[model samples]
Target: MEKKKELENLLVSVSENDDYAFRVFYDLYYRSVFRFAYYFLRNREACGEVVSNVFVAVWKSRVALRRIENIDAYLYVVARNEANRYLKESRTRRRCLSFEEIPISLIDRNSPPPQRRRSR
Candidate 1:
């Protein structure tokens, strides 16, 4: 509970244009945010990239963040949304297999075409 309060105070301090308070905020949140991004991305490099991007944005918009009631939740939501967007955008079209787009030729391509029996 105390930790939460301290974080909120740090956020508010930054929001009030105390630029130095961001160092405290960054130290408090960086690793946890990276881990959260990792959960969604599963790529260390991509997760770190996203986490860094989000934190930079947060610092840039710190003044406007005064109204955030919960900085942890807010930053997490930002990270999750960013990760999801990154994953979706980076997905390969070929790997995104659609049932309807199944290659009927694949069934025949690898083996002899199926022989159909005629019923009297």
Candidate 2:
């Protein structure tokens, strides 16, 4: 509870655009958030991206930080959403093959064009 109160104070200062407060908040939450993301993503690169994006969002929305009721819960939600989005996008990308990605040999080059029948 004391730690939560301290974090709430820091969040208030962060909302006022205090750089030191923001730094302290980041330092305190970054590792834990990263670990949470890692457990879900299981990929170091994706976990790093998720953690970075979560902090970036917090920094960008610092002016509204005070509106957040629980910083830890907010960070966890953000990390989870980002990890799920990344995994979904990766799956979609793997399933979608671009035109250039198709092998040329697989195309039927000698296929005859269908002749249009004369209109009666």
Candidate 3:
């Protein structure tokens, strides 16, 4: 199809580190990837983060762009993987923060002192 050929040309240019081609490729895919991530993440901020990380990864691996048979499928897989990773890490962070062993001394040190009762 014409669109596939256009994407292939853009991908080839991206592999060569052409900024304009990369921008075009990003523009073509970003919204779809974000929506895919949001479907799994169900959080706006997390979906945004996943979309960003997916594109960052694509840019980093641009040299391999030529080998990708389906850019849409590739982007969706990356988005899904990043969203799952984000969810796992978020769960781990919340679990760690809820530990009962956390020292009270580690809490904020600048708070006002507790007031004493004045009644005899």
- Quick one: best lDDT, which candidate? 3
Q: Estimate each model's TM-score.
A: 0.67, 0.78, 0.81
- Candidate 2, residues 1-120, lDDT tens digits: the string is 997788789999999989999889889988999899999988888898888989888888898889899778888998899888888999999999998887565465676655679999
Which parts of model 2 have CA positions greater than 4 angstroms off? 98-100, 107-120
Please give, for residues 1-120, the per-residue lDDT of candidate 1 as tens digits.
997777778878998878689887888789999999999888998998899888878978888787888777889998998898778777866477787776666545877665779999
Model 1 weakest 10-residue run by lDDT: 105-114
Model 2 scores what on Cα lDDT? 0.87
Candidate 2 versus truth, CA RMSD in Å, comes to 8.5
Q: Could you tell me which residue pairs clash in candidate 1? A: none
lDDT order, best first, reads 3, 2, 1
Each model's lDDT: 0.83, 0.87, 0.88
Q: Assess candidate 1 and give its TM-score to the true structure.
A: 0.67
Q: How far out, in Å, is residue 24 in model 1?
A: 1.0
CA error at residue 112 for candidate 1, angstroms: 29
lDDT of 1: 0.83
What's the CA RMSD for each of the models?
7.7, 8.5, 6.2
CA deviation > 4 Å runs, candidate 1: 1-5, 92-120
Candidate 3 lDDT tens digits, 11-67: 999999999999988888888998899899899998888899999999999999989
